[model samples]
Target: MKSMMMLMLLLFLMPVQAGTPISEYENLLITEVVVTPTDAEMIEIHNKGGVTLDLTDVYLTDATFSNGNVYYYQVVSGAGGGGDFNDFFARFPNGASIAPGAYQTISINGSDNFFSTYGVNPTYELFEDGAGADTVDDMVEATPGSIDDDPGGTVAGVSALSGGEVAVLFYWDGNSDLVQDIDYVVWGDKREAVDKTGISIDGPDADAITSVYLDDTVIASQAVINASSHAGGNSWQRGNLNEGNETGSNGNGVNGDDETSEDLNNTFFEGLPTPNAAAGAPPAPNLIINEVDAVSSGGEFVEIYGSANTSADNLSLVFYDGDTDQVYQVIDLTGSSTDSNGFLLVGNTGLSPDVTIADDSLQDGADAVALYNIDASAFIVGDPVTVNDIMDALVYDSGQADDAGLLTLINPGQSQIDEGSNGNAANESMARCPNASGGSLNTSTYQAVDPTPGVLNSLCPLGDYYATADDTNATTLRNTLHEIIDDHIVFPYSAGTTDTWDVLSFADEDPNDSNLVWMIYKNNSYTWKGGGQQAYNREHTWPQSYGFSSGSLGDDNAARTDAHHLMLSDVTYNGNRGNLYFDDCNAGCTELTTDVNNGVGGGSGTYPGNSNWFDGDSFEVWNFRKGDIARAMFYMDLRYAGDVSGEVDLQLTDNPGDIQTGQPFMGLLSVLIDWHNGDPVDSIEQIRNERVYSYQGNRNPFIDHPEWVECIFVQGGACTTVGDDLIFASDFD
Candidate 1:
């Protein structure tokens, strides 16, 4: 019943307006007025009236007192006009006009001597049902049902008890249309938590002032009655107040729902103990390219790639050696477009690949080898490869083979003659240098020999063969193939939409040239397949194996999880990536096997791969594309893996033993090594199952941009594409 009554009352009071009158002689309705300290030196007057009223001639007065005498003081010397819901006091200018009806206010610092001269004995009255400080009968004895009743009967009426002290009565008229608005009030040592209590009855007759009391004892005869003019009190209005703690809101009449000045703070903060305090700097991108080798004896360049995810002004790249004492240039990347947290940090190039690499065997100053296409001839024919050399190819060089004997065409064997020191051997007819027929072919473009200066040089030379061979016929054939899959490569899709494609005929019998993907928008359908994987298969460019999910898309979900699962995969070879996210989970074996046979099987009549690796231990089986898995996994890890200390509190290790024990997917490393060695498939079948791409789409971005892949390939002797001639010649060797 109380709740219902309060609800109804709230509804009724929601629309009530202050009933201040417009007459020149009418009294100003005072609203809320409060002083900060109990012994505040100055007083403030607040008017809660409904309309504009003049206070210029109106004076605040205080009744004074002596041993046996009483007095009063008129506080203001000049008359000032006050506006509706506003205020005017002796010290400060006018504020919001007093409204049309009930109001409450407070006053302080006015003269006390004048009250003694006017026969007004000052008293600190703690009122029960009250409105403003000016009312004579505003004080009442503590009542059982009154809203102002506190835990203790600490209420009292005005009666002078000591010098340097004063008090005033507050009243709320029962018949007034407006309830009094109280912020808080204080005078001398007396304080009250205001309740807008009032009488419901109307009367033209004056109400007698309640008897003055001292120390809980009533001095009935000393009580003074007030009707027309009350003294020592003033009223004012509340102006702009903001909605947060320690911060003031501005603008007129802008009150917070609660005392937000004592509450609420920064909305974005989490894990914070106090209001208005920040935790620390946000998480940064995890990228560490420890050492970059250009495989050249001359100076080489290296790049560290990742999003800074801060304002351009805050984007800085610092480079240092192992000791941290040797530092490189500090590059300011303030204007990069990839600074947007959502966009891929891109085009932030680093070193060129033309730098020379020194052989470990040769003396420090002996002849150095230059890196052209990731192959280093500085070392002996079969010297054990260095982690540094592999990282160099991964970080700075690309398009080189990962085998024992074949000389590299791009970074040729160390011989002056066209014939290699090893032999002229397995050189495949060169693919056109630019692959002009395919507008966006990946293997065609030159790698970024130097990124800081933004220069791209041609990859493998077309050589004199271009003038000797049927160049026109070859280009026409390549063009025809490009035309077949022209529209399938696009990027940047609207969120929450799927791109669909259909398998079609290809030039030659290239399986990668068959299928295409497209996005539907409005009435027209567009193909935005991007590169690599789009031309290959619906490869989870972000490997589905590492908890990557197709259904989740945002940073909070798919991008978050899949971001960790990136790697290159053959569309056909990815049969190994089966339905299993991770092969170690034992509880969901049946489900894993089923999912692999269904979604990832690619509807190929034959099961994805039936190698011994796929035997009965469901959790032990992996579904990666063995034919192309090594480079893919390397790319995936390079794309997403960063300094993860911030997110999962995990650490990264370069130790090979960690991949077999300390790491979660240690077993997969061996599988990848075997796949890279072509152990999963025989020579002919390995070549047949390889996934080729135009280098469009997120899946094949590294292959499309070998410069970026150089950072990774150099660290591991992993190769993605092999020249047919190189493979055949190595077989003969």
Candidate 2:
């Protein structure tokens, strides 16, 4: 029969090389394999260990050996069956070896085809002679068959590998007839058949061919390690090959079969074929989409944050439209980089972007802005959104329905962030609070704020902090605010460690001069000479004499030393205004002049012309600081309730007669309310609130939300409405 003649030819063609085993045989791995586009077919092997490995006697084959017979499926050209048996397998010739951390690629379709496809020569050529200069190692091939014969159903040859195949790398020692299976990988549906059964060919008795099924007693069980099939032009590669050496095995102690599919769903990702190189995706860029301004106005832009002065070469900013769920534009950032402050921008003209696009390029809502570590040319304008090589993304909508495809790019459990949720004006932009605080693909940390391109994002107002506070009713809102800000970390008035003075030094520090403290009453800057006999002393805006005088409640009285009401003041002015209720003075009051600068208080002589006034029984603050003084008094009334031991229940009243020493009350509340409305919060007051919050761990609600004032004070617990009407009523009352 023709099968017998072809078997004889296979024996004659294979050169008898002495099968010598090397100790480093276990260090070899079949890293990658490409079966489609036959001319580009190749197999990549890796040397994972530290030393170089001699590959002589190493066999790469698709044939399965069973009981002294080789079972293989032959393919000649494009068709199956009746080809040279040698074309189905290959062996590493003498002097063939791989260095540590190096890769050796075997060109299954000859060196010319591999070079034309990948623009690089392969390490070895299997189907052609290696007399050419491009071949790194000459591969030994099997002999041609004399007669074309069909040997049942067997699939062989790397080019013929189109799913349902297994590639094995092994070492053979001829002296003791020992065979060591190094690596094995089975793809597609052939795993079950390969593990269960094989065909048997009786040696010289040609007609004695039969199928051999495995039984428990005679079973030659081989470990099965499944891999992905070649369907979408993707090759199966060892997972996490770029991270470190792979330790997963084919349930055997062999090196080549180290990759298992236990976490295939999570770890597997699609990518282009990489011949003779590291596999898997490259490292993602350390960057994020920090801010976005996508209003109807043509000034829309996106900000990126990353390490300072790092190059953004090959990174791209892609915009997706909600209607089509496809990319609309790709801004190439090949020549761009983050500035010294770690910020970069892509926007319309006049915004000074690092990369500029056309006006109105960004959709206002129900869209996405994604940053990817890929070239811009590779992106198609109408392609669906993909997570491949994506570094960061923001899915947003103004009032439109959420785009499910755009949402898929973000982290799980996080929904699309609405640009209009926080009631931002047309000129405002959505920014990541606290800079880059959130993890990758997360939008929970963003908030609408005044756009601050190329700089740190503004600390968003603490709206979520008051989520449990009842704002519908005035009394409930006040009580809820008290509970939210109560039990904060209390620093000592004066101690061997960090005290109230240390906090005030930073809290009341002159914005222009770090060495000076801005004195509250004098409205001027002075050098901070620490506590006793100093040029400035701590003035209690809500005087301690009325409720918590020095030692009346012992050293633990938080109300007496509270930094919210305590301010740095000139020493002489502190005594002049002692225990006086705040009220506007008429003609005969002593006029205390104020200095210019510090953004407030700079006039003289005339009654209350940006100057402090006093009439022995009452003190009036200058024009700019009236709101600051009123808010401090409001905090004291809310903070202490006498419920805790050694604490006082401070109250604010319209009658000055109720403000007696040793009593828990402060007055002329009607004048204080007028002062609060007359002088709104400024930059100085906002800075002071933030500084005090740093140490005390509580904020003055009036500084953050000025609208809450009328609700709690004038509405008498009925705070159902907000806006100009409530403020207008409070102004007249």
Candidate 3:
């Protein structure tokens, strides 16, 4: 029994015929190489095959010779009398393996030095002594009597792996004397024959060569190679080579190398070193034309977004005119880099730009601005649109015809952005909302917002905020909008901490003068008096008596204190327009005057002029703020559904009897719709919307999408046309 067991053990240990050898040359790819900062050198290998790879008996070396025939050898300890070349070459330990689609980084210098440089430990270290106390695995050393073991002369291993040296990975069975070269890479200079003495050899007069061999057969020769000596924290990385070779194609020939020297040079790029990680494509210029204010004024500027602290050298911002679809201006962006927050502003003089151009250099619109990865000199005036090197582009027009030729360079399927669609292009600048999102070259990501040139962009809500709202049915859309804006963070009407007063103070503060408040009723600015009746007061645009009375629920009433419908008003004007339904009153109404600032409202006397007019039963907000008041009414109608305990179901109608009775109803709905359509959202309204949202955590959907008012109230509502006038269902009831 003992003799049978011994024979079985011996049979199990004996080498069997190699069944279908793994084609490791194509499966194990040399991905990255860092050859400088001697102590931090590294080589990264990737397992592109589908199955895990057993690395046992695998060898890595930097020595190959071909005088009479190609002969590959391993480094040994005490070679050339006393040189310690053991750390230069590595042999895989018994259980070493690499999983599919994973990376294995071998620290050529030392594990400690690699960790110090890359901030992460390497997978395996060639020198056991270099690992120190770290948990990094160590590779086996070459045999002591290997081919390079000379007794007398001085021999050296690839300690620095300096430029012009080749690194090769192979598999060898010492017992059977079978060798198969797996991968090879050489850099810094073209291949040239060298004498054996150059590598401190003593026996054969063979010449050292730069080539790959498989089972002693020459497969590839490095006649032409990458001549770049990637030093100073840069590395040569493999890219696109494994794209079609993932399933293992051994080069273009049957018995040739897996990749040629030309393939290596074309695919690899000098990129930041990535140890123990997949080396992707080298960093291309990742800049986007983030913001543009081509207002023809002095403050015109363009903002760019990119990786923080990265070089912006050799980049240019080009402007194209719509008429000819040609280059109009080019701003050189050399010698500038992104700030710590990844923003770079190129503006006219006096705007503190990272790069400065002449004032008013940017055209207003029917134009385009593009960022390129080349120099400004590459572009000339009147040159036709060039899309080859465009990194990002924004084709825009101020309500003009689309520039079809220029739009082709932008993101696929996106149209030319209309900067004037918001109706206040001069006071606003086109910016990428949510700040640098929505990918590159996409004009759909931009919105006309209050200009914020050198800082983070405004957080404008996306147009899809009411994505689930049912537009086909008016009641469904109204209900969906209510759900979206409900459950808000309510603040007390007056409190020691944040309150309605605090919200209105910031929401209504003059855009130009922060110390003054813009009165909604009077259309003028007043000293901010902290809710004092003498200076300014909070006017519930949808008066509280209609649905949400402050006397009934006090400060706990959300609808009563909601900032969306609240505005700063002159204390006396707030009384003059008390609890009246919004309507257009003419001839017999008392007119209140206005003062203009921030590009809104400064006129008087005429029937429908930019002045507030009021009668006993109705009040007409100034033309400049009609949309503001109409949107407030719309918000009230949607916000209070009376589902909650203290809430009331408010409604809008064209009936004066319903509003006069004050039974949770307000308005002449037809006039409000006309007002909303006539006065589109301006910058002041947008700023005020953002401010109110900051405190109340809710937004007026009408202000965000004024077109939805007609979608929900006019086309979708239960209405009848009587003599070309549309009246709501409540009017008949």
Candidate 4:
């Protein structure tokens, strides 16, 4: 019974058939070598992989071909197929195996005196750098008893090398068909340096005493190492504790620091190489739900980054309502992986999610998303889950964890939950900054940025050049700002359809759909796929007939398309409003045209303002829209104030119909100022200001700073320098 049990256990633990290719393993590499001078030739191989590997089919070749002159020497004798590698150099014994994280030193033919320095067996290959003049290598027990492999024989250098030609090293993994070219180094393109395509060529020149290592990945992209990259001595050795391949680092470059241990902290350092060891911060979570765009107009999404040396096997993204403990969705990431740069996106499938999650799982504001290392089958709502099993947990905000005010990070040293000025608002998403640096997920790490679901965050452009804080006298501030964002360029009248749509969407909502839309004319929303609108057209809030048409005397000018005064209203309403003027529609105000008396367009409707009354000729903007209209009128006033042609010097009055017909003034500065104050600044207007500013390169100081309207028009704040040549604005108080 005991014997049967033992046999069964052995069968279960035995290695599976080699269905997977060698490339599927982490990696094995040719870490270092003494390539220059041939006499004391030797090269080092490392099992940088996670598991011990059988070397039966693996082989190494020291060869160079130039001018059709093929020079070759092989290691692992019969393994180098039979081509240019016809000759045998030094070889590994029959069934030698390299334990995980171990190194094999093969010493080629050299002085016996040097070989005696280390007790471990070392074999050799015949690959020379630059013939008789090649650089000599330093030999010693780089660290005694470090390597435990047995020694082997050496083959002679086929030909002495001179400087120009590159000596190539090919470490192929396979027996029957040398299929896997694990790694190769192409140095010095001087002579017929036949660069074997398909691998990254590392470094410009070869000079360091240590092995030139690949700084970013497992493969060496260069054959040069910084002197400081090595430890006490100059041998670029393997990581101790078997963490990962020791890589070099540039500023903020991927470091050996997988965040696992200090030993594997970074590739670049000034210390003795700690061979065969574990080190670094701790591997960045293999995959992290680094960013989430829960509030988006198009669709919600989650972005992930792979920061460790692991496969995307059983990984899954789960979304939950922290309050309900109800698991909503599970997105299996099986076989899905981040790009070489460690980025993967998942969410609304239409946005091209790598592994789509149920759209309902994603919700706006206050939710928790976790990267679970387990499979979906193991996940259950209300089931107890341990943080130890979580690769990363991004809690949107605190929601009763042990009754704590803030959700304590299960592994929080860095940001784990998106916090701070992440103004959890509509159409915005929180994302990691300086990305993939898996630390604590807090405000500093994850920030509220514009929704950039499938890509990195592009923070809203808040330039220092624009005026923001510090309000001054409205008139003075207005004049000061006018000089800055003044008329730089204006789109053609033909461009108004697109521009007007943008303006409309910015400041107002489409009554028909409530979604921001392109209104070609009132009651008509322009469809990009369809033809033009019917009765909808651009209505100049400050009419065009006041000597400021798209073209003066018929030449299309900026005023014709300046978005500040452009609006989309019913053709009937607009024609009714025309160039008449704006005034109080209540029975108290004068010039109450009979148009209103005769059952025309005066209504208690929900528009322009809470004041839903319109005068006959001068239409009354709704109370809600009053401020929006007032600000636009004010912007139009200031924008053209400095026009090159003094012909359109408009006017402003405090009374209805007080100005003559041909005069430029819109009317009643007092009324406009009152309207500005009544409506005040709101988000809709602010959005309009931002969008319009983006296009016109100008701002309505009135909307931005309503108080400024009072300061400039009421507080006697008009610019005295440019006195008359103006009207009511010249002398204020």
Give candidate 3 regions above 4 Å deviation: 1-458, 461-464, 715-733
Q: Write the per-residue lDDT of candidate 1 for residues 114-159, one digit (tens) a residue.
A: 1322234222222322333543212222122121233454322122
Candidate 2: regions farther than 4 A off? 1-463, 715-733
- What are the lDDT scores of the predictions, listed in order? 0.25, 0.69, 0.69, 0.47
Weakest ten-residue segment in model 2 by summed lDDT: 215-224
Question: Which of 2 and 4 is ahead in TM-score?
Answer: 2
Q: Give candidate 1's TM-score.
A: 0.22
Stretch of 10 with least lDDT, candidate 4 = 140-149
Cα error of candidate 1 at position 446, Å: 16
Top candidate (lDDT): 3
TM-scores for all predictions: 0.22, 0.39, 0.37, 0.35
> Candidate 3 on 1-733: residue-level lDDT in tens?
9999999999999999563245543578788888776777888999887777778867776544432333343221122111133224557777788888898888876677788899998898765544145687776655543313436632233454664566767665553222445676666432312112112222222433333323211222232124447757888887645532211333321234433332354346678887778776555556788888887478888999864444577888889988888998888888887874467999988889998888878887789999988888899999999887788988888788887898888877987877787898778888877567567878776888888787656557557656666654676777888998887767556532235776787788887897888888777788776744456788888888886775555434788788888888887889898888899986699988777777767775777777888888889888888988888888888888888787888888999888844478888899999999898988788878777764455678888767568656785444222122333334543
For all candidates, the clash counts are 113, 5, 0, 60
lDDT score, candidate 3: 0.69
Model 1 residue 156 lDDT score:
20
Instruction: Give, for candidate 3, the lowest lDDT window spanning 10 residues.
Output: 74-83
lDDT tens digits, residue span 158-218, model 4: 3222222222323333222112234433222223223222222222233322222222221
